[model samples]
Target: MSGNWTEQRIPDQRGRIAIVTGGNTGLGFETARMLAGHGATVVLAVRDVEKGRQAAARITGNTAVQLLDLTSLDSIRTAAADLRAAYPRIDLLINNAGVMYTPKLTTADGFELQFGTNHLGHFALTGLLLESLLPVPGSRVVTVSSTAHRINAAIHFDDLLWQRSYSRSGAYGQSKLANLMFTYELQRRLAYHGSTIAVAAHPGVSNTELARNLPGWMRMIVTGLAPLITQKAAIGALPTLRAATDPSILGGEFYGPDGWGEMRGYPKLVTSSAASHDQKIQQQLWAVSEELTGVTFPVK
Candidate 1:
């Protein structure tokens, strides 16, 4: 509700347990660091064990590492099982891992790289861990989307994998859009159970390693204008951290930067594109995601 909400406003997270995907670097690392610093038992769920350990070593609080390669469903399943075994209750699940603007590529499961890793991977992980969250009052699932969701984005049901052809920007937009849709749909499902909630947030234009896959020309352009347009990853992680820890946050809400064009500033409650709020598409994508990942939520 304040115009200047910062990480310091995060209530003491002394007893909460949080799982942050891709916590080894960039926005994920910053998110994990802040949550851990605030007293939450943070798990850095990364694809690289060594990097994860290094990340955990950097944080000075209750933190641990877990291997989680979003590109592989097997890895997701194993990581979820291990987490369930270790923690009886999960207070937060931050779907902070994702790819962007990559060349046409598929995950190990044959889905488009961006869609699979960004949307489906998180979709499956959340479902697998839903039980651990259900019993925990005040639990939350914070999914990281992007402002890119408004750029030529649509859920292509006819070819969800972009099998025929693909545009790097378009595919990335689709994946980010799916992240918001999944959050809204999941929140609707969670409403019936009345314990946990789903929310979404975006970093705006952050200077993070997520841009490594951009094409040469675009990369050059971005690099040239990076100083004026991009915010540091730490600042960018605020929206997500706020969504995860803000006690006043509600289900299905989206958060992002408060600056011009939402390119950079303090975190605030923001509105996504109209299409992203479409309940019909959100529900349809939920069904397709379940069928594709073979991971179904326990929510009725």
Candidate 2:
């Protein structure tokens, strides 16, 4: 997927249906735009209805927006159900919505805001929409993660709600790590059941609202430094786009930048930390997710 990738080689996406969380802005917007530009019918599953519509209008490709507040389980189920009722199949589902660096806050569901919106909500949505996803054999689900995950080690199961100590970066790391774990677990399950859908992807560095939760001055500094150090949002979207449409992709493979320590570059197949690849932890997290969500995946 390195130098070999060219816009010409990309497949014709006309008539394909795709769903992108947070598709109104940032990397998600770029991803949705690229997919839609290639002719896929994109559903912009955004948190804000008005903003989503505005964003959809701004995009040159075919797209529509629907309400999707990832902070609430009910919201996820309702939106997913509506999508299922409207679309016969989803060719791609990009879990690109996220928050970073914020004072500890809880969602409408009483879970940590970032974890709830970033991990659990997508978890529930994916599970509930198994009907729409599975029938499309080569359909892919790309969960966006950050390089910050490499330094994160604590899943903090005992304090999952962050009832105890709290650190913004730590919590963000855990949520992003969960994205990776969930991807691997889904891949394992699909393989075990011989399902053809492939799941993979992560974003390394890009300027986006996801960092809105960051400390004010820190975000300013990050924005200030991003020009020199950060990849543009379009480049940031490449990994996810590749994972979604690349015919050569394999399940459980992560993609990111190839530049300095993988912080920025065109999307390519990148490896994560060994801990991120641990199957034992993956299984444990999967168990906890099912127990916590009370929604069993339809895949056997």
Candidate 3:
């Protein structure tokens, strides 16, 4: 497909149902808005119920809010149960929620905050909801990764939780890298089932609250270069929107901006790091994630 893909190209979604995590703000919000506007029933699965409701209110059409605290397995289970009861089938599951460059912190489950939330949380959520997606012929699972996945990133099997020492950037990289690996491995698994598909997309550097956790100096540099380096949240959401809606999109394909260095512009299929394509590492991470999250997919 061309790099000029836009939300205008999204086909009618009259009977589709989309669930976007972190849909309360930023790229997730824009994605949810466009999907709902295109006639899909969208659920803003967010950490904060009130904020999600407010976000839903801002969008027209069939939109609802559901509580989903990715940091907590209990919350994921509850939210998935509710969704299963409400909708037997789901057309799109967008793993758009994530934390970046957070301080050394652990989730309720004691895993590193960034890895736990960005990768493992989505991993568990998708597995728990696999049944709902499998029966839907054209269902998709789109996970939002990042360019940072290539920045000296690895799974860090020895210290997956950053227990020995921590660098915010490194942990964030691991999490994002895991996102890509998960999508690739998931696509492979889904191929056997021959129902749903898995794809990944990255929002080119966007001006969003996700950057609030950056170091002081980095934040200052970003602010100074914002005009040239960052795009609006709506623009940043294009890659994900395309990954979710574009009929030509294939399983395991990744999308990102078309600008220089992929910092900004229209969405197009993009390549991830060599490390991200390592099938052995992807399988290992899949096993680790399942063990860590205690949620296994129905697929082999």
Candidate 4:
């Protein structure tokens, strides 16, 4: 066995608690299910409460769905506050909610749809829930990003909201790249604070709801070729689960598929693109995120 996910087994997560945003369907739901099955109390945070209930009902084990609309900062804050008051500790936070290609849409806060939901929302959620995370000694945050990041010129500070120009593909790429930058920067911050949390993970070319914002033809084409061209959502969740639960994982290192070209397979330590490691860009993004979201991480 390769000692990656193939040889790996789900550890004892009996006492763990997790929040998985957009977890009512697709990769998020699968990841939530896997974690719950391994004995973690999983919270499936979704935009639709009724639909979330329906989705959680399909899973064989225990799961709870809570209303969480990432585009709204108010919703994110409220959810985090409520969860913090309820759960004793949050063992894992899977910032998995995101939007992919859309014609041109803006969030409630007037940010680009892809960039807003994918990067900014998760960024804010992590910041808001920082208190809950620190209480859990072995807590970890596993953020999901895509290979689309390779082409991304991250954080066009001049046109942060894509007001001057916008392309669905470009916006999606930039958002995914932001995820990587946030992940790395978060690990650095955790180390600086002497905290016991680790953060990492990537899912390359998985069949998921991320493309719900794409054109009809694009969605259909991708759906048609999903089984052949991409890995299933179950397999895609492995890397994220490993990062969240595995004891051997170290902070700042990313995990992705081990198959050819990273399209599909079990989880393994994978390298991120050079641009994902740009410290200056990470710092700039972190600062900008705090300003835009109005929620600075209260870390010393």
Report lDDT per candidate: 0.94, 0.81, 0.95, 0.84
Better of 3 and 4 by TM-score: 3
* Error of model 2, residue 277, in angstroms: 1.8
Per-model TM against the reference: 0.98, 0.95, 0.99, 0.94
CA RMSD for every model?
0.9, 1.7, 1.0, 1.8
What is residue 141's positional error in candidate 1, in angstroms?
A: 0.3
On residues 189-267, what C-alpha lDDT tens digit does candidate 4 reach at each position?
Answer: 8886645565667777787766677788888898898877688788888888888877889988888999887888888
CA deviation > 4 Å runs, candidate 3? 1-3
**Model 2 whole-model lDDT (C-alpha atoms):** 0.81
Q: Report the C-alpha displacement of residue 114, candidate 2, in angstroms.
A: 1.3
Candidates arranged by lDDT, highest first = 3, 1, 4, 2
Q: Write down the lDDT that model 4 would get.
A: 0.84
> 1-300 in candidate 1: lDDT tens per residue?
545888788889999999999999999999999999999999999999999999899998999999998999999999999999999899999999999999899999999999999999999999999999999999999999999998786898888899998989989999999999999999999999967999999999999999999889999999999999999999999999999988889999999999999999999999999999899999999999999999989996
lDDT-superior candidate, 2 or 3? 3
Candidate 1: residue pairs that collide:
none
lDDT of 3 by residue, 1-300 (tens): 444788888889999999999999999999999999999999999999999999999999999889999999999999999999898999999999999999999999999999999999999999999899998988999999999998776889999999999999999999999999999999999999966899999999999999999999999999999999999999999999999988889999999999999999999989999999999999999999999889999998
Model 1, residue 257: distance off in Å is 0.3
